[model samples]
Target: MMLSGLDHLLAAGLVVAVPLCGSWSQRVLERATAEGRPDARMRDYHLTMLTLWSLAGLTLLLWGSAGRPGSLLGLMFSDGMRVLIGAGATVLALLVLVSQWHGISRLDDAGREQLAAQVGSVLQLLPQTSREYRTFQALAVTAGICEEVLYRGFLLWYAAVFFGVWPAVILTALVFGVAHLYQGVAGVVKSAVVGLLFGALYAATDSLLWPILIHTAVDLQAGAIGWALRGARRGAV
Candidate 1:
């Protein structure tokens, strides 16, 4: 479907807005963590993410409804090699999660402490209690779904209206990376590379299913790890 001029304007606005909003949010998170307000940080971070991403997802849904009602579902659940590829990626992500958990579990108290400190800034955004872990899980899943819908699904579709497929894919991947700028240079680079892989997968299958699965798995794994690390620190204390 061809994007209208208004659609193009909205897409352009999002492309610029998302990264700027992310950078600003990251600063807020960093400040909260540095100030020893982990609980507040966790609450605010999840709330903000859930609200913004929900709006984004709703916007995509509305757009899809107006033009191609079932297109989003088709992109997600169509049976094909793409589905197989997405499933395989999910398996790989799970394996990586398991490996990281196992490695962390093997660490001594001092090692674990050091590791926790190393990523303390990120970890500080996690829930401090087991109950809060459920909330974190919801947040992670929301992130996976909403982000894929906005970045991979909507953005790619919009870009493809103007640019060729490959160009759109590259542009989308770059923006995806830029959105994670708060993660620092290495994080941005890593996210960009991952984005490239996701873009390629989407191009291959024309589905957001695999990328969403992989992204959700990765986020949940990170949340689990952070929760575990927090528990370990509490135990040590």
Candidate 2:
């Protein structure tokens, strides 16, 4: 209920970044609009109008984690485990890149069509999502940014700082897995795996920059594909 100075400081640091990241995302939209992208629908959420609120709550969580019995955060920062986890991540990513490459090169016409049908089937299972108006878009953007900082920045950092690199990675993955509890077991498992992948990337790269870059590229591709498909379906219908 009552937070001390360090708690306040950490919370302030984390919360402060949320708004900064959120605003930065909004500015990205503005810049895109300037270039004639004009995604009016994706620019309306007020809470996410280039800022968000999340400090006290996250601070408390981090503070609690600091005193926890086990801390993967602690482990991640250790001398040996850090390198091991980091190296593991890099190797996995390279393999993934290769697999993706092979997949693309190996697909034929019928294979592509069958893959398309499978993708369509999977899309049918996605929750009936709606378009985020320009307003919600900003908020969604804020959520994306803040959520990343909250989980990766603070939580993951905490685990690595307190636990051990390996422990931190595993603990963070568990936390990440739980975060997807709403998505069911499959979602949880997938998210957990992704969290591990991201954590490993962070460990290997020693910079959030690469993971963030990779995330941006992956998201952009997915977004573009979705947009193209939607437009094509609309035209056909």
Candidate 3:
């Protein structure tokens, strides 16, 4: 209710977009399965299409926020500020990854293989996989940009504008927790905890760049850990 201006617009875009995009993807996957061939390439194509449309949606959102031709609302913070956030994000990501790589409690050999196989399903190993990979890469990048802008960037602004700094931070974190409901129970719990953590970081720092960078690093680190465990299992075999 307190949200207004560009802050409101961004928060609204996120609240609307993710679920719509995900649901569209579910439909596409269902169609691919029903078609009988169900090639990975086909799935990849759908993902590409999905990403393109998402990009398009993002453009519209940006344009709407701009409300003027050839000139738009500039980022909430300075470029210098963004660079610092980016630096913090890099540090946070490395810290989390290295910690998890060495410290993430691993499953046994069987579990490693199972995890590997699960990763393989989304591997995109074929000719089309590369494109699909790029699509997903873009999707990840977009997520990093939009989610941070929306949640930590805009939402933080709203909370501070309507409430005080401390309440704003707490409320933003609460929204962060609620935002992950689509991730399922475990995901929801994890995301909520992490969301609040990230939210707090943003509030303290007042930059989305750091959160975006950290988010990407976290994903990559998790991916690497899974890859390492898989490699170890293969070596065992």
User: What residue runs in model 2 are displaced by over 4 Å at the alpha carbon?
Assistant: 1-145, 231-237
| Pick by TM-score: 1 or 3, better one | 1
- Candidate 1 per-residue lDDT, tens place, 164-234, comes to 77888888888888887777776677788888877777777767877888888888877787776885556
Per-candidate Cα lDDT values, in order, are 0.73, 0.49, 0.55
TM-score of each: 0.83, 0.47, 0.60
Residue 48 lDDT (model 3)? 45
Q: Comparing candidate 1 with candidate 3, which one achieves the higher lDDT? A: 1
Model 2 lDDT per residue over 80-119, tens place: 6665655565566556655765574466656545544444
Per-residue lDDT, model 2, residue 147, is: 45
| Regions of model 3 farther than 4 Å from truth | 1-10, 20-92, 102-108, 113-131, 222-237
Q: How do these models rank on TM-score, best leading?
A: 1, 3, 2
TM-score: which is higher, 2 or 3? 3
Please state every model's RMSD to the true fold in angstroms.
Answer: 3.0, 10.0, 6.3
State the displacement of the C-alpha of residue 35, model 3, in Å, after optimal TM-score superposition.
6.2
Cα error of candidate 2 at position 108, Å? 11
